[model samples]
Target: AGDPAAGEGKVAACAACHGSDGNATAPIYPNLAGQNVAYLENALKAYRAGERGGGMSMMMTPQAQSLSDEDIADIAAYYGSLTP
Candidate 1:
């Protein structure tokens, strides 16, 4: 199982734009609260691999690159557990 506790700190950087609870304050940023873990994992990996990001999304590439598989899973689990 993903460790939500660990993810809390791992996702702190994301909170700046995605919001502390995964609900982005900016409309341009997609709300990640209650998002699917598989989807989040894929997106994060894609962003890291430079296969799915463009424009503003590209900005996330560096952050995603810093994550390991475990971080992705944990962060995905944390955000997925929230209400959308």
Candidate 2:
């Protein structure tokens, strides 16, 4: 796995909606902290590949597009490391 701390900056855009702590202020956005790593990684991949659809699909597509496999792994680790 890559460094979780290094992925924090790349994930800053997510914090705007998901919150730095992953507790989204908006009810529509799901909380990401403590989410299952495999689930989170799969969802991101789905969004990037357009296999998922919803408001989040568009939002996440672009975000996930630039992420490498390692980036995804690190991000999943970072969020999974957080407490709800």
Per-model TM values vs. the true structure: 0.92, 0.89
lDDT for 47 (candidate 2): 84
Winning model by lDDT: 1
Candidate 1 backbone collisions, by pair = none
Writing each residue's lDDT as its tens digit, candidate 1 over 1-81 gives 677778887988899899979999799888999998899999999998888756667679999999999999999999988
Residue-level error in angstroms, candidate 2, position 29: 0.4
Where model 2 places Cα greater than 4 Å from the true spot, the runs are: none
Tell me, by TM-score, which candidate is best.
Answer: 1
What lDDT does the true structure give each of the candidates? 0.88, 0.82
Tell me the alpha-carbon RMSD of every candidate.
1.1, 1.3
Q: How does candidate 2 score on lDDT?
A: 0.82
